[model samples]
Target: MENKTTILSLFLIFLFTLPFSAQESYFPPEGEWETKEATAYQLDFAEAIEFAQDNEYSESRDLRQAILKGFQSEPYHKILGPTKKRGGPAGIIIKNGYIVAEWGDTERVDMTFSVTKSFLSTTALLALQQNLITDVNDKAGNYLWDDTFEGPHNSKITWKHLLEQNSDWSGELWGSYDWADRPPSDKNIDEWRERELHEPGTYFKYNDVRVNVLAYSLLNVFRKPLPKVLKEEIMDPIGASTKWRWYGYKDSWTTIDGLKMQSVSGGGHSGGGMFINTRDMARFGLLFMNNGKWEGNQLISEELIKEAVQPSKANTNYGYMWWLNADGPRQWENIDENIFYAAGFGGNFIIVDQKNNLVIVTRWLQPSKIEEFMQILYKNI
Candidate 1:
């Protein structure tokens, strides 16, 4: 009996000393990253591939030609710069920091449209973190003394309001009017243009002109081109590729503090936003999923992230520039509420699901089918 008891104790020690079956973290180093089978993460490989193939966009119209036609007819289309030829359906599913599944030309750099807003938002957050300006609620007029932040209606706007897209900032930015963007189809042009301006923070309107104004203000605050700020601070640290580019219109350049600076756009409404590949997008999503940390370095504060994803009172579905899956009419179905994404026009999305340690980047997918695709993706996990 004594011998048996000693043997059992030795067996338990050995078992406990062995490594557990844990998911491997394969954060790509510089330019090299490895792919793993989906089954390694307990995902059904066949189902994932099937889901990807079945959910492909099946539009009757040629997508790029249609997009070009639509954008060319916009009121301020000329100011939007040129629309780039977009790539076909492409995406990468990253699980536990490894590429578990990918399809299409994942390396092809393509226009990311409005997803640039999230990066713009991050730049603003970086400003806050660096104490360039104190408090997000502080009035914008304090830092930006130009007419852009002037007047009765615009004077009341705050950094927080701009971040949330509820500033109701009444002005012309980069030759684009605030009311001209996605004007209410139900109302006459005059009625929509002459409508009373809602007080900042009390109403939400997704106007690219206003978003451009935010980008312009950030350019002033940073005292440098927005892209340089993004690259030196966020992108470089996260090991993002150099392929991504942010663009502003030809007229958007201006003299600031004795230096010529180009104010970038917050989205691709007129044209030119982030043109990045799926891998770069995945790196960005992974950075957010790790709570703004990468490779044991805290890139952006967790506090900023908390505020970035917090639901706006005006639009519960939006926070800062990141879309929140809040309890609202536009909420996604059957997914973790904590999952947030940077969505762009033309079905470009960088979805961050921290709950499941997943980052999904899909480009040129059917926008309406996104929720269903996610539902299917999660089911495999």
Candidate 2:
């Protein structure tokens, strides 16, 4: 009787001491996700949900109008790809890969804008892992001898520079000139056109044309459509649905290996990026939250993910396409500095909090209110 009691006590202790993730970690299967009550985790996130609902993004649901209005200051800014009428405020909060809370139409597919950059950056990481390209620090021109990376300044650009958006790459891509994108308000068209170029890796500039150049460069490296590369390598293995689509400009086509393929965009700023649903976005967040592992498969190297989140010298709050919550203008006060997220136009965000084992996907929440909303959610967590 004493021996039985001793064994039972040891078993109880072992069960209690197990790490939360080891005991509760889950990976949602295709077309199905499980949910658990927030109360089970001793969390009350109703206030956060209410805040998100109340602070829906004020932009027009007709994203076409919003896109044009938002970039009216830029010369020759035009939509070149597809745009969807965005849905109302939608979000999902996942703890240990199980949905604890959700609101609005989480299934509705919508434009994700620059969040696509996170995915684009992933492709480059994969290329590195597969030894397709030797090193990110290598001159990008070496991979493809085409004129895209020909000039003195352009040739100096490296994959790492482009990943961090500090390339300052010059010239035109798919009819969009690098200088024309996000030009300064104080400068006229010619002045912006003739502006002095910053050395690659010295300055950080958020330009879609430059981003497209990265996409185009990746296309030449992969010798296939990026969508295919993403689907086969990352998405399908993670059990993502078939609904999501990556888009490029209508004329962003190029021949590779004797087959014509579109070089996708890194964002939807000019109307070409990723269109995906909130649930799938959560799956992606979960994958990252798990450090790029999906069910024991290391889809991407853990070292690469760690490298991806490290803040770049040019932007303390920016990593390889991922936004960090470091000490910068974008930092959220009182929040974990390690927190990183994928943000896009129209208030789309996929926030990954590794310390808390939390993945939050919120769409169409007021951009300005995200910090407060995060605070509220963290308060509950």
Candidate 3:
């Protein structure tokens, strides 16, 4: 009888504890993202796309069908292609700030890769707008800590250099099985920034570590975590609640002996570990469309929004975290110089056609001819 009572008590304790554990999150102590059902915004998919006469991009559904048909027929997309063989699936197109077309998977989440850089750019801009930091040209050493090797790199390296992909610290940023493979972790971002490197603003190398430096810089300036600042300033206000979750593996940030037990917070540009649904990305595009004012609150200044999307630093058409290319030996040359976009690995895109009031987002895992396929789709649209 005594043993039976003890076992029952343990069971009761477990039952109570189960709920607590289930509700626990690895995202650190933060406010829960209030959940709400997503409402669909009406958009005509087809008419505007096929028939150029409808300049307004009205027939969104027809455009959607065309995208579907292309997905089925396009050799590059390989609708039936194996998982590893393809870059991903479904091309999402949001026109006039509404989802007008889709090809491949329907709102499936995929690793955003470098597009996270664009998101990071948004965060950096937000920091600047909030006056948390005065200048993008501020030296890395100003906000980040010091190190002998990385100091030269840090002193000359400004936030703009990082944003423009011109940082010298970027010895290896992209490619496979090289220095590029191992992105700088959330821990030691400052140390990495301070590592010995040549003069900053000297070249255009796609480095992922620069963005980590940017993140750390922002956190240091605000005296708070980047994730928390981002949530309050950027994500929540803009309705990016659903798919926007900051990554921090486990026991994300803690301390031991006054040292940073948890070094880094998230990934950098040229690569980020962002996982979000298609709808929320479209919503983010919408936030840019609405002048960065979500529900009447100015999340980002109109001036900053324009700068973030339009090319400012390099001639390569990279804006903040967005990529604004003008017919770069690709298919979509007709696009006005004003067109800007955010492209990710596995052929994902969030394109904004400022002239047409359009935002097109496409995410896929197509293997065969990734770039060719994407360019073809853009031209066709």
Highest lDDT, which number? Answer: 2
Tens digits of per-residue lDDT for model 2, 126-156: 9999998899899999999589999778889
Better of 1 and 2 by lDDT: 2
Pairs that clash in candidate 2 = none
The candidates, ranked best first by lDDT, are 2, 1, 3
Q: For model 2, state the Cα shift of residue 290 in Å.
A: 0.5
Report the C-alpha lDDT of model 3 over 320-378, residue by residue, as the tens digit: 76776554432245456667777754445676665555566655533234344344444
The lDDT of each candidate is 0.82, 0.93, 0.52
Span of ten consecutive residues with least summed lDDT in model 3: 77-86
Q: Count of backbone clashes for each model?
A: 1, 0, 38
Candidate 1: clashing residue pairs, number:
1
Which has the better TM-score: candidate 1, or candidate 3?
A: 1
Q: Candidate 1 regions off by >4 Å?
A: 1-25, 45-49, 54-65, 71-79
Clashing pairs for predicted structure model 1, backbone only? 80-270
